[model samples]
Target: MRIYLVTPRNPESFWTYDRILPSLGKRCIFPNLSMPTVAGMTPRDHEIVLCDENVEEIDFDVEADIIGVTGYIVHKPRMLEIIAEFRRRGRFVVVGGPYASLCPEDLRGTCNVLFVDEAEETWPQFLADFARGAPQAEYRPAEKPDLTTSPTPRFDLLKVDQYHAMTIQFARGCPFNCEFCDIIVVYGRRPRVKGVPQVMAEIEECHRLGATQVFLVDDNFIGNKKLAKELLRTIATWSEAHGHPMYFNTEVSLNVAQDDELLELLRAARFTTIFIGIESPRKASLQETKKTQNMRGNLVDNVRKIQSYGIQVQAGMIVGFDADDESIFEEQLRFIQDARIPVSMTGMLQAMPKTPLHERMAKEGRLIAESVGDQFVFSNILPKAMSRIELYKGYRKLIAELYEFRNFRTRTLEFILNRGRQVGEGLAIRREELRLAARVLRDTVLSTSPRRAWFTLSLLGATLMKRPAAIADALAFAIVHKALYEYMQSLDHHLERVIGEIEAATETMTAAAVNA
Candidate 1:
């Protein structure tokens, strides 16, 4: 049977930066790794075509026996649309990935089949059954498959020119169980890592395809320290021998700061940045959320320690825990600013379906009376102590303060001065830094608006004259923030629409109750 794997397009959100990214000559940051992975899992006899709507237009008229759509919670609406479009054409549509895996009921009417959980164990069987003209309504893996057997994803199917980086996964799952996180629920707590040779082979494939930067799309890359160290050591040797063609990035727990050898290995492997989930600064909040691993040391100091190894930190922070009150937003912002974390991906707490937090909320009668799709569109649930409006206002204020040019520039400079001293190790590295600085300077000085040009120049002058070491760091921060600011503006508009819809729904419910 012919198969077309689909990744649906995301409606631009407050956090979308596509519009302003042209100024920096960057496209979207990361490509879809899941759909391609599913494509890789298909048996050799079956013909497979992959289309990521983010990079390609969907051809509804394209003839295929089966359509496979995969996405996460945020992309549910688009996934539903894709399924409906295919089903309307009398084609069999399979829905899977995090959203469908967590709650298959939401996809019942739209999808002819639901392949939940990891695809490796179930996908081959699903294809075999479909080829026999017997497609089941649902398919799930009986057990998690070993990562070593997973194929190098079908990167050939991607439009490499349309993205800033290609993604590869070395590992799955996390060791720590943060309450709000869905990683453990989805992949389990015992970390599973691909063998070093398997990972290196994938990297070699990406290199052969001219991918200069690869994101290791692991929830916690170093969660298994011994295995991770082994892989990094091999990667370091391979990268050095091959002229270090690719720079790596991945997410990890903050405990990475405790291991000096691991940090050295990561730097040697050309790993430049890490996304750490430093959820909150308040120790009580951390404990409340069961993120006790982060409470092991001074939070800011741990972050600085990682930065000392020349790895930039892009952290995730959330407000609205049971222990949190109104002051949480300001405190969170101050902590982020004080740490000089350039990319602070702050969001209101979301009790995702099937998460421990969600179960507890449902038990306590705190789960918002709305569908999972609605929650994805807006911050639907609220903390027990705070009103919904207060939470929304607080989120807005925090984002506004964090992205303001003056505050962003100041914090970035401070972070650079603190971390830049550790990065001046060799001539080659220095040359790369200078090249990036030059490009950033050109982009900033030649901005579209005169006011933007003046602001960019002023910020550039401040970094170069006041703290020369900070120029590279400041440039990186500016590129990310410029895109983030544009995305946040879009998000604000989305939030307003979501609020209006919620109000209308509430009014309709009230009127129906009165009539009854």
Candidate 2:
């Protein structure tokens, strides 16, 4: 039997980083680890082929008995479209992932089989039933599986060199209930962790496959602090034994800063970056969202302490919440700049399906529409403090200002200068990567514009002069931010057109209502 796994590509988003990948001569930011993992779970006798639509085009003509597809918010429409084509070609379609787990009804009729929630338990069961010429239309696990039983993701199945980094997951859940987040809703709040040996073996597989940079794709890596430390210690030992080949990064709540020893372990384990979801600094907003972990400490101080350990922070912030006002946007911008978070993402509040925020908004009759995919897009929920129009406008302004050249440069410089940088012993930066990074920076300066060129040259040249060892990593940062700045410009242009079209349609509706 031939099983084809498809990862629907995100056309335009910060996550894919497709716009930035070309300059670095890499195929994609990271391979969709979910597809490969699911492929691994299937019996080895079956011929499993994985295609990431972001990196390569989907071969709709490919022959396969079963087609397994997965994706998140951005991939919903694309998945539906792809499923239709498969069904027409007389193929069986199975749909599952974060989007399907929460919004199963969306694909009810489209999929021949639906596997909601964790597939670790349900996948094998479905395969057995199908082999016997009998399969359920839908199969959801009665409870989250013990993550320890999870199989190693099929890293060997991937085209290793195409990706700049490989990804693996160490844990399954987050302890805190952030109202808008869907992680807890899908994988319970108890934080089911993988055993230390399991995680170490996965990393070793990545290392063996030539993956130097590995991302721990857990929503919050330290949800179970004790388990996290154990994993880190094992990772440090394995990385050392393997000659310090694998560097790691992941997301953690702000509370990770409180544990000084944990931070040391992460650095010793060769973690160069961490993404903190410091939603908002406003006490009222944090309280409203139930992100209680962030409220415990001075947000700015926590960020600084974490960065001081040589693990630079890439923060995630939100602008649309019940307590948010017009002032919130500027506050977010100011806080990010002050905190020296060089790479921060600001998203409008979106009440994802079945999340606490979604339920509350639906009860209040504030949810005007249900079409939400892109994080940068407006929420279906209407804000109590502001209009939908105001929310979109503020979000656009915030993103634009945050990525503005001068502000971006200032933030980057501040972050690099103050960052508690990890020792270079574990880093395996290749000479070719350095040269490609240099070309991207050089072109951005000489070709982008005189002002941009000057800023790029001056800022990077100074950093290289002071910290020559930072040249490769700094160049990688430069490549990312430059793409981000350009992507922001494109978003601005797209949003203006969309808003204009919306206004025109609204006026037409009003005119029609008056005539009626």
Candidate 3:
């Protein structure tokens, strides 16, 4: 039987890196690890093929007995359309991934089969039952499978060159219970990690397949701190033995700052960047969200400490908490600028399905809409201290000011100045790096945005003069700035439409109430 595992096209957003892909000569930021991972779970006898719609179009006409569809909440509409098209043609469709796991109700009655949460067990079971012609309509695993027993993702099936990086997961679930986070709900709070040999083999496989940069795609890389440190040590040794063929990036909680040895190990393991959830700068907001990990010490200092280990700290920031008022926007702007985080992914607070935030918002009758998974677009939860319109306007202004050239330039330079010592002589420069440098130089020189070009050049200069080792990272940051700036410009128009819809809904509800 022929099987097609498909990842729906990602909507254009900051994470998509749509604006910078052309210059970088990549189709998408990276392949969805879930698609390849699900492929690995399929029986080897089946003719399995992986298609990430971001890199290639899905051919509905392809001869396949079963089609598996997966995506985040943002890709819900596309996933539904894909399933509908395939089902209309009489092909069996199976749906799963974050969206399916978090909100199975949304996908019920749509797909022929739905597998919710951790396909490690249920996927193979379904395939076996299907072969015997007695497959079930849904497979919801009651237990999260052991990561050590999980099969290596089918990275060989991916068009590795089409993506900016290859991805692997060393662990599942985060230890923290951030109220707004859906990871804990789906994967649970107890972090399950893969064995060292398994993780190393996967990295070796990615390296063998010519992946220069590997994103460790763990929700929180240090969730299991002891195992994480052990894994990092082995990775460091392996990288040294292999001439450090690939660098890594992953997300971690802010408490990673407290572990000096862990930071060193990460550097030794060739981790160039680690995204942290510095969700909000306000202490009250942090306490409200149960992100006590971040409130342990000075937030800015923690960010700096991680950066000092030569790992660039990218951040996930949120706004529109109940504790936030109109003044929160400027506060966010000032915090980001002061923190000197070049690429702060600032978005409005989202009440994701199955999360504590969602439950609280629903009980309080404040949930205005289902989460679209793109927080930058809008929030689903209504704010308590201000009108929804005020929240929208403030969010728009915050994003705009945060990405302004002057502020971005200041942060980039400050980061360059304060970042910690280099780990090893950086990885051997490749031809692609040379080509990307040339493209950046040419494009910036001929660019319409003089301020942006100057920002790029100034950063390039700073890295070269102070931290020559970080020259590649400097170029990457410049590209990120361009992507964020252009995306935010488009986002402004989208937000206006959302604002109109909210107003119309409010007016209709108010009118109905008056009639009643």
Which candidate leads in TM-score? 3
For each candidate, C-alpha RMSD in Å?
Answer: 3.5, 2.1, 2.0
Each prediction's whole-model lDDT (CA): 0.78, 0.84, 0.88
Residue-wise C-alpha lDDT for candidate 1, range 1-516, written one tens digit per residue: 688989887656433457644544445656779988887887767788988787678888888988889988778888887888888888878888988887778888777888789989888888778778887888888888898899878888777766777899989999898888888888999999889988888889888877778999899998899999999999888887877677888988899988999988888887888999998999989999999989998998898888888788888888778878888988998898888887888887888777888888888888875334333245546586676756776777788788877777777766766663432233255454466566666666664457556657666677778776556556666666666766777667766676666567768988999999
The regions of model 1 sitting more than 4 angstroms off are 13-16, 24-27, 370-377, 420-443, 466-472, 493-516
Sort order, lDDT high to low = 3, 2, 1
Backbone clash total for model 1 is 3
lDDT of 1: 0.78
The TM-scores of all predictions, comma-separated, are 0.90, 0.95, 0.96
lDDT by residue for model 2 (1-516), tens: 899999997777877676767776778878877888898798899999998886789999999889999988778889889999999898899999988988998889898999899898899999999999999999999988998888899999888888889999988889898998888998989998999988888888888888778999999999999999999988888777767766789999899989999999999898989999998989899999998889887888889898889888999898778899989998999999999898887887888888888888889998777746677755677787876667777888889999987898888887777777685542666776567866787667666888777777767887878776666555666677788888888888877776676678778989999999
Which of 1 and 2 is the better model by TM-score? 2
Clashing pairs in 2: 310-420, 310-421, 445-453
- Report lDDT (Cα) of residue 170, candidate 2: 88
